[model samples]
Target: MCYVMSYIRMAMCVILFLTLFTGMCVADSKGNLALNGMAVQSSLGHPQGDAQNAVDGNRDSDYKKESCTFTKTEFNPWWRVDLGNVYTVSNVTITNRGDCCKERLRGAQIRIGNKLDNNGNNNELAATILTAPNGTQTFSFESVNGRYVNIFLPGNDEILTLCEVEVFAEKKLLINI
Candidate 1:
């Protein structure tokens, strides 16, 4: 009788452990959410510097390659991407213009949120570019839930240029055990 009781308790314990573990396990997949997102900027510096180029999955830094975005020289020039749905953003990777003026991206602010106020530039500040990048830089941070990401440069005669902007996030699937 003692042996049978011990075996039954062990079996119950194993079953309980498996059920709790299964419930806690979340299937998550991380991907670039900005790849197919809609992008826009304050103003165009050139016809070839369309905002869509930043999300074209190309990191070509050379403007001549026609894979970068340029904003006309203005105060607080900003660029933004509309992520189709709200996500817990993990990080933001930015490729600077390598052909010529890489310093144009310095002092830029990255904001993320669902609010459309100020063209979404007034959202939560995620990161700031402290110095000019030679090629590319990735800014990782605590997860922020938002549907829009904006890059804003605050100053007069400032030009915002981005070769590529990649937003990474993980989508989690909850499983009920």
Candidate 2:
């Protein structure tokens, strides 16, 4: 037979490309990183690709010099997102940024990780994906988990923008390399 049917069709195309590209490579934290934990400091914020430089909110006006440029105002460029580690965040997605969607963006807030856990208490600002009528605001934080994810960009003088920010992890995915 044609060389055993071309080696069984190249081993069934390498087992269907290893179960459809490794079928969501499973292990744990999507890409593994439990070497003892504690050691994640991702600059943890906006200012990328230029969403009006991400934020310089509440500038001057007697606030005693804090935010310099990029403080147009409709709400205040809010993107304080800082979910460095301590996973368990269901979902989060924000898009269309840089030149900002012509300002006037009102309502967008999130605050996680009040700390305290370990039998202390506190830690409970769960879910508030801006209720509704806030279209354009992408969010799917299923169970309302937390870990420091603040993104309050509401009508900050009409200056809002985002370009793909998806952070989701409920389970599945270890190393799909």
lDDT, each prediction:
0.88, 0.40
Candidate 2 residue 7 C-alpha distance from true site, Å? 18
- Deviation in Å, model 1, residue 29 alpha carbon: 4.6
* Number of the predicted model whose lDDT against the real structure is largest: 1
The list of candidate 2 runs beyond 4 A from truth reads 1-23, 30-76, 80-88, 91-107, 110-126, 129-150, 156-168, 171-177
Q: Can you write out model 1's per-residue Cα lDDT over 50-105, one digit (the tens) per residue? A: 99999999999999999999988999999999987677787999999998999899
* lDDT (Cα, 0-100) at 1 in candidate 1: 100
lDDT of 1 at 142: 83
84-103: candidate 2 lDDT, tens digit per residue: 45556665544323232423
Best of the candidates, TM-score: 1
